[model samples]
Target chain A: MQWWTLFQKELIENVRNVKWVWVPLVMILLAVMDPLTNYYLPQIIDAAGGMPDDTEIQLPEYQPADVVMMSLGQFSSMGVLVIALMSMGVISGERKSGVSELILVKPVSYLNYITAKWASLALLTLVAFSLGMLASWYYINLLFGALSFGALLQVLLFYGLWLLLIVSISIFYNTLVKTPGLVAFLTIATVMLMGLVTTIFSHILEWSPNRISTYIQQMLTTGSVPSDLTGAAIVTLMMIVFLIFGSVYTFRKKELAS
Target chain B: MALVTVEKLSKKYDSSPAVSQTSFQLTSGKCVALIGPNGAGKTTTLRMLSGLLKPTSGTIAFAGMSQNSDIRNSIGYLPQHPVFFKWMTGKEFLVYVSRLAYLSKPEALRRAKNLLERVGLAESANRRISKYSGGMKQRLGIAQAMIHQPMLLMLDEPVSSLDPIGRRDVLTLMEELKEDMTILFSTHILGDADEVSDEVLLMHEGKIIESGSMGELRQKYQTAKIKLGFDGDLRDYQEKVTALPTVIECYIQRDVLHVTVQNMTAARHDILTAASSEEWPLTSFAVNRASLEDMFMKAVNS
Candidate 1:
């Protein structure tokens, strides 16, 4: 009940917080605007060059499944931006304002405070991703033909994992840096670093035929999606653990009298 | 009955001690003033006592030990400069903190609103804290500090930024609550200290310089003070009075020659005799009592 009270406060204040709206607006623009541009790009290209003589322009086949996949994938990355933007001051802003002292002084432990923040953000992302996915599921069918719900579910799960990954990164950044500005900038920096490292390692590992990517490509190309739940379950569990435990661990050392 | 105790408390940022080996006791219903210049560990000590900063080494015990579960509900703190969520109204912020402090919803609202009224901020309580002036924000800070009605209230320079009116408003509220709560407040404003505290704990260079009631310290530290005022050419008369036996400190200010004599009864007689003999311009010669500020400066400087 007490955690709920704290969560409610964060929810109210965070939703009212200007950054929350700004970050989502930016994401919404990316979600809808990019697809619209891609849909109209061929026509724009042909009009710009005035069309070659006696040439027939072949339009790429449209699939509502494709739209959903493209939109979810791009918006999934945007999810990281939203979460990072909203959570930049998870630790440091309170420290700056000297509220850490007042808050920690209360009966509430640093654990509860950090957990409440993570839970609030998680709840927010769950709802946002759910709504965005459910909406795009229709918009994709409007532009293309019928898509499989199973495919939609897979894409949604992928988007969900991406959000979880982002939250983990945010919580980690929020934990490591106790200053808001540094936390925000460092979070973005860490994401870039992670991408760079992953890209370099992916290239290096591809030389010997990477196992993880090979399995994923096999699942995609050969329609051999793994029936076993082990990898997905483990990743989901780790994401949950990282969010709750990582936040509490980092928050413990933070002085409430910040 | 030490309501709060700090033993062997120390904090170092990298290497230098912010608060070094500091220890003190706060009894129930006793107002202890933690006085010092900036960086004198006043804030650090306050933070440690209020459980804001973890001491690099040492322990903080409330009513005996550092178990927060038992004591967390009964400690109220107003930081040196508390930062509030600007979007939250003062009342909302206070209620939120009160809820975090474990008050029930209705009780939380009641206590928060009552505190706002106590601090003379009831009308503006609905306004966002971001829109508040420095003084109003300070007042709001105090109101929230006491929302829990904690057994011990630690205020860090609570009224340092207030204008005269705001200072009086807060100091008056503090005076009223002093008998009801243990106040561990910090400030360099001797006037506020003299007005509100039962005992003063003066700090300098990370250690307490003195601790006592004003009269008690005066009785122990130095000779008595006597005010001797005489009409006409007080500077010349002050010179004569300093020359008198038993008189220690004599300074003339605008025809009032204030004299601090070692023995008041003996000095009175000598002054009367000299006035009659030398025909000095003397309308009156009386002893002026010392204020706590004088005694405080003596202890700190000593």
Candidate 2:
């Protein structure tokens, strides 16, 4: 119950957070952006009711869920943005404010402090992801065509996968450093590595799961979970591995000083 | 019973020791003040005792609990500088802090209200702490600390940021709280410690060099010198006054005279009678006792 109070307080703080306001605001904006991308984009390129491409104007064959994938791209970008800003202060602000000393004297555990952060960030990702999903279905049905329920489910699944990646990365940021600026920088660097650098790394390192999330994004857009499911499973496991190691490494040795 | 016991505690960053082999014990219903110069380990000691830092060596026992986590449950700490989330309102900050201190739902809300009111922050409870004055923030620190009614309350330089009125308000609260809990606070200011401490622990070079009840310490380091002020020039009767068998020393301050007799009780009457027989029109006379601040300064300097 005490742990829950701390968690709830973190939620309220995040909700009231000026930065927190941007989270939902941006996500909802992405929500608004999803349909806008589906609607005006084709018309803008065509100008004469037909888009100008090398061959002809086509939206690269959107799956019933491709609308969702585009929406995922929008929301994921927002997630990365919000958590990046949030990650900067994971432990740094507390050190500055001396709240660490205030909380330490309470029969509060190091686990409590770490756990509160984990819970708070996890909740933020969950709520934002859920909001994105709702927006994804509404946009696709309204702008694209008749509902493809299977594709709808696949898009929702991708939202989960993407959120898992972001949460893991954010927690890693929280533990590895003390300052918010460093946290933001680390998060951006890690994302770039996972999204882009991993492609190069994977070629040299044969068993790298680094580019797996990008592949998952590809599969979700096509409305297929993929044949083996082995690669995706391994990649998910790797994220957990990174999260466990990162969480244990930094949090275990973190000096609870204010 | 000792509410807090520190043994051979030390903290060092790189090669310099911030606090070294500091040891002390505090019991319920008593207020012990830690007085020291800046970087004398007062804040470090308080932080360690509050479970904020890991000591380089040794142990701290709080209400029979050796673990910091256990100690934290029973103690309330007011840090030297208090920072709120800035985004949170005063009520929100207290709600969060109160909950962290383990107050239940209604109880947390209730405690937050009561503590805010106690600190005279009820009107500003909805205001953001970033808008609060320095004194108001200090008051908030105290209010948040007392929300759970912790058995042991520790404050580190709490009054350093407060005005005289604010300082007086906090000291009066501490005096009122003495009946039920143990308090151990640290400060560098001599007058602050002199007013609230039942006992004083003097720290220097990261070590507790001297400690005792204020009276015990004052008498232990009694000075032979006494303050004496006369209606006329003391030099006129200096020889005669010094000739009195009971008078050991005297010094004049302004218009009042203070005489220190060799034996205060036995020679007090004789000293006065001698003055009367001499036809000296003495305006005032009293025993001059040593002050805690004087003893503290001397101990630290020595």
Candidate 3:
């Protein structure tokens, strides 16, 4: 019940700050723009008027699933950064403003406090990402061809986990730091470092949570789940659980100092 | 009826101790002022008692609780500079905090309404807290703290940041509140402490140097004195006042002659008789008692 109350405050704050509006808007714009830009690329290049008259540029044909994948690709970079930026101040900003001191003095536990934040951010990420992916799926079918709904659902479930992992990382750093900007920077840096290591040693790091993106891409195009998909998903879930517990622990120690 | 007892409560930040070996007891239904100058660890002691900051070494025992039970349910705390969710309305903020204290929604709303009215914030209850004046926000902060109906309400520097009028308003509110529950408020301003608190705990250099009822502290540090103000220069009467047999020491400070005397009655009779006989200009004559400022200075410096 206490967690529910805290969650309501968090959700209300997100609504008041227009995170509900702009976060989803940004996601939809990125998702829809991918399909729109790809469909009109040849004309866009022609309209630039920089190419010679005899130049013949042959663009590759884009399947419906490929356009969706490209949209997720945009999300992988810009969208992940947006989630980090949105959630970076969840705990640290409250502490800095001294509101956390007042709230924590009540009969509220650290676990409830941390989980309320995580749940609120996760809810926003789920709704915003679902709307973005649905809009992209609609555009993909309209501009290109028909795509299976089951494939889109699979893509959403897998990729949504990756987005939630970013949210957890952002919240974890918020508990460790005083400045929201530092939290954002640290979260982004951690995600990028994980991606870099996974890419450099793909064979050795096949069990990494970063491999969820690869499984996402494979599901989008080939309609077949990779053998390591469950392993990567489970690892990602475990990492999220660990980050949450770490957040609760760190928050208990650092709350007074902040 | 002792409400809370703290023993050997200490807090060390890094290597320096912020609060050291502070021991005190709070009886039920009294306003106790934690009095000290800045950096005297008043805020540190309040925070540890409020459960906002953990003490380095000590034990705080409430009257009816077990050793390791959560004591926060019985305490409400307001920080010196309280920052709320500026986006929340005054009413909404109170209700939100009450809910965190484990009240059901209906009970939360009911208490929020009652508190807003009690604090004279009913009209502005629907307004966003960001739009509140400093005093109004302070009233709201107090309301939120009391929403849970804690037995002990601790405020750190409650009236130090307000204008004269706002200070009076909060002081009046605090006066009304002390009738019901125990209040422990910290202040560096001696006048506020003197006017409002029943007992005072004086802290200096991380240690509580003095703690007592107002009358007891005054009696212990009282110095019998008389102040004389003349229409003309004080230096003229300064010599005459010093020559009186009852006067121990006569000094001029800010155009007034402060005469420390051996006996209050003898000094008054002697000075008045001398002034009348010599036809000296005496604009004001006051029999003075030692103020809280003097007591605070002596306690802190001692």
DockQ of each: 0.63, 0.53, 0.74
Provide the lDDT at A161 for model 2. Answer: 58
**lDDT score, candidate 1, position B15:** 89
TM-score of each: 0.88, 0.82, 0.97
Per-residue lDDT of candidate 3, residues A196-216 (tens digit):
999999989897888887777
Tell me the lDDT of model 1 at B290.
Answer: 63
After superposition on all C-alphas, the RMSD of every candidate to the true structure, in Å, is 3.6, 4.7, 1.6
Kindly list the per-residue Cα lDDT of model 2 for residues A163-241, writing each as its tens digit.
6666667677766677768778787788767656556666654334444445556565555666434465566667756
Off by over 4 Å in 2: A18-20, A28-79, A203-213, A217-223, A227-230, A241-249, B66-69, B87-92, B123-127, B224-288
Whichever of 1 and 3 has more TM-score, that candidate is: 3
Docking class of 1: medium
DockQ of 1: 0.63
Q: Report the C-alpha lDDT of model 2 over B4-106, residue by residue, as the tens digit.
A: 7789999988879999888888866789899988889898888787767778898888765546346666778888887767777788888887777667778
Ranking the candidates on TM-score from highest down gives: 3, 1, 2
Per-residue accuracy of model 1 over B20-74 as CA lDDT, tens digit each: 8877777778888888777788988887776667889987888745565446678
Model 3 chain B weakest lDDT span, ten residues long: B232-241
Task: Give lDDT: candidate 1, residue B125.
Answer: 88
